[model samples]
Target: MSFHTPSDMKLICGNRNYSSWSLRAWLTLRKAGIDPELIVLPMDTPEFEERIAGYSPTRRVPVLWMGEEYVWDSLAIAETVSERYADSRLWPADSRLRALGRAMAAEMHSGFAALREELPMNCRARQRRLTCSDNAQSDVQRVSELWQTARQQSGSSTWLLGDFSIADAMFAPVAVRFNAYALDLPVPAQAYVAHWLADADLQEWMSLANKEAWIIEHEEVGE
Candidate 1:
């Protein structure tokens, strides 16, 4: 239950209003009780281009700095945090459940291209309307099915699993997308999205997102 907080920990991220990957990593660290120094670089700007190279080899956001070592990619950061803070229980103890969680997280990470393109994670935007393509609709349906299966297996009505794990962190941005676009979903998935929107940490993130002035014009979809 106790772990040493790293003094040299820092998390380099992008504008919270539009960076779903950043949200994932930030939520994971916050859930693990680690508040790293957050460095927000506005995306699609000369500043980001110049500064990102110093922080991430991938030239991406949500890179975690543990002393001189840096971990890029949100999933990698989640895995590292889960391993380093085993006592935090970032993943379920049961092997089967853990496997299922990993699969779900991986699917979210690799798939859902249509959903990501059509329904970008705009935390500050809400009650917006968008006519999703067939592929995007299929993606939403797939996400609903995944959530239903995970909750049914774990008997958890709140989180995807019985507890808040890396799986939840991975899908947290999807929840924001669903809410922001007012995407029509099944009752259970709707409830899940509501739960995520109600999370205090996520609310704090959204609060900061709303205060951000820089907006990615391309990501400003859904009228």
Candidate 2:
């Protein structure tokens, strides 16, 4: 399938209040300045399958429907947008930086299972003093170290791997989760989280997320 008008491109997403993956894809599109039509649907509902079957084989949120072709998976969606809009600087400009950023994003896309399980992405909820499992703490430690390391490597840029790229989009949800759960981070990671929270784009998304009334039961943490 081929894309025609910008209006023809659609982003099929799920509940903004709970879907981390959706947020990743949506942020990537936004970073690329591609504002496609957003198609949101209720998740964990009986009609969810019927609603999303046409958009994704996996029946997942964040299916980028580019007229004739649809891309599922947040990482894949980010890659597609980067390739389609090379001028957008979705990835870093330097080849080595770009490669490293991709590695970080890829690791984020595939790892951090413990963190995800213990602290699901709850944008509107803040839970302080929740006990973390050893595994979860380990995951958090790794994340903090990675953030500090990336910042050091970035050399004066506020964003990871220097400049706002797909890697930042990938880690955006983690920043949200850290803030929501009151997870402790080292000075560097804490600063990185602050940067993400201070972003205008993230603030906009948070505003929309705050307006969402749908609450997924399992996603609510420390309640």
Best TM-score goes to which candidate? Answer: 1
**TM-score of candidate 2 to 2 decimals:** 0.94
Per-prediction tally of clashes: 0, 1
lDDT of 1 at 194: 89
Clashing pairs in 1: none
- With a 3 Å backbone cut-off (N, CA, C), the pairs that clash in candidate 2 are 1-68
Report the number of backbone clashes for model 2: 1
Please give each candidate's TM-score.
Answer: 0.96, 0.94
For residues 137-156, could you state the per-residue lDDT of candidate 1 as single tens digits?
A: 99999999999999999999
lDDT of 2 by residue, 1-223 (tens): 2323387799888878778899899888777776678888889987778989878889888899877988899999898988896474888778887888888898899999999998988789775557889999999999888787777777844889877888899999999988888776888888888899998778878888899888888887684
Candidate 1 backbone overlaps, count: 0
